[model samples]
Target: MQTSLATSVPSWAVGDVTVHRVDEIPLPPATGPWLLPDATPEVVAGQQWLHPDFADHEGVLRLDSHSFAFVVDGLRVLVDTGIGNGKERANPAWHNLRTDFLERLTAAGFPPESVDLVILTHLHADHVGWNTRNVNGEWVPTFPNSRYLTSRAEREFWAGYDMEEARRQMFRDSVIPVEQAGLLDTIDVPAGGVEIARGLRLIPTPGHTPGHLAVELTSRGGAALITGDCIHHPVQLAHPAVGACVDIDPRQSEATRRELLGSLAGTDTLLLGTHFAPPTAGRVVAHEDAYRLQPVPAA
Candidate 1:
């Protein structure tokens, strides 16, 4: 059985761009404690604000896996494809999913062939799973007509990496198919980041991966930042020191988070968490020494 979109698609207005949060599987409750070990029940309890939305009253965290889709200047763009269906994965939660991801994508008005660009935040398994889909006997590029993009550093790093069999399997099915099809592209995202399309830019948010990126979209005076994997959930906003166990460079990841949060602390820039659960989009506000998200529910 496939999961259906529970409601009409949740969306946000950023100046001229209307971003949509395409539904994917909500991670299991065990995901929170495993992903962020530092965010213990005690720590979660301390933050009285996380309850009802981000965490249970018992202090269990809530996380999700989804993608952001929208059109800007006639280009249908999707940021970070979630864990794909039918892929073999080491994580039980992500293994061989059979959700109606493509159907949901088509319903969002950006069918696979209609997509103009697919921006990869990083090369992580969950983030790049939908890059390809098993077709008959082989994994093939899902978006046949779209140009796939990722930071040059990300690919190069993996090229020289001695990956575990699990990761190698992920690339063979997800990443390599896109590259082999001549659809994958590599861009040099500098410290200041680079603009790929009009009003769309990629900010270098490394440490999760050597060349991880966070997508940014600007229309008129309004702006939005998509946190690829740099910030997994809103809990990170209140506890910047709490790091994901999977971080490649925990120190660098923290620095990037702090700097990124500082820049958007008081501004009206809308922050969209790639793995954030319900009410995913928000405004970053200064709280004590760090920041907290003021959720901007879809309209």
Candidate 2:
């Protein structure tokens, strides 16, 4: 079934902060088993609320790779740079190609040069792809003036991780280049949480990666949470135990999911999913023994 898609650039105001969604690519429908190993079609089909938005009538998941541009206290901050153009990646789908992400960012009123800070929730290939871009012949920081922030644990883990050749190439081309330019800032992972700006902070949500952190925004009386990769899709809200194969620790990821869902359910806090399709921001609601995502009405 086909449904009218949300605007590519959706904006939301959290008290004083303004956020815009910058989409790089709308991924093709994926099978339940492929994206979430334990989620079968029969199981996903039961998630009636996911249809026409997060999933198709046939139970195929609708996912996207995008970034959130946040304007906090007059400071421009971006969360999770999407898979960039012209980068060699371990995933064939992300291999060298061209995208208009920067252009979209510009159109959304966030030119790369204006970004004050670029936060990488984790050092995954997709999350940090746009940290740097291929210039004349050198890899250069995309947001030249922005101070790139990432967790110390994440940088250390990936630095020595024995991964495939392509992933190594990803780090060399996308991550290391930023460090070489003296633009990367490794923050100590917080036990509780640490404030990055006036109303913005990083909440450690490890398990997906050693240092994965979800961004929290609070302004006035409004609150929003950006789930970097801890909760990829709404399906995970229903089956918190169905961990992604890419997660470094599946069990840990599961625990984090349940905790987050339980804490945010029936609250006014807005949940922004990093990979959720259109209408990406929603509110968590309790569903029997698990949870469900109720998309926020478009404004």
TM, every model: 0.97, 0.95
lDDT of 2 at 69: 93
lDDT of each: 0.91, 0.86
What TM-score does candidate 2 reach?
0.95
Give the per-residue Cα lDDT of candidate 1 at 97: 98
lDDT of 2 by residue, 3-42 (tens): 1123446788788777788889887655345668777767
Kindly give the stretch of ten consecutive residues in candidate 2 with the minimal lDDT sum.
Answer: 1-10
Best by TM-score: 1
Per-residue lDDT tens digits for candidate 1, residues 117-161, read: 999999999999999998898999999999999999999999999
Give all candidate RMSDs, comma-separated: 1.7, 3.3
Question: Model 1, which residues run further than 4 Å from truth?
Answer: 1-7
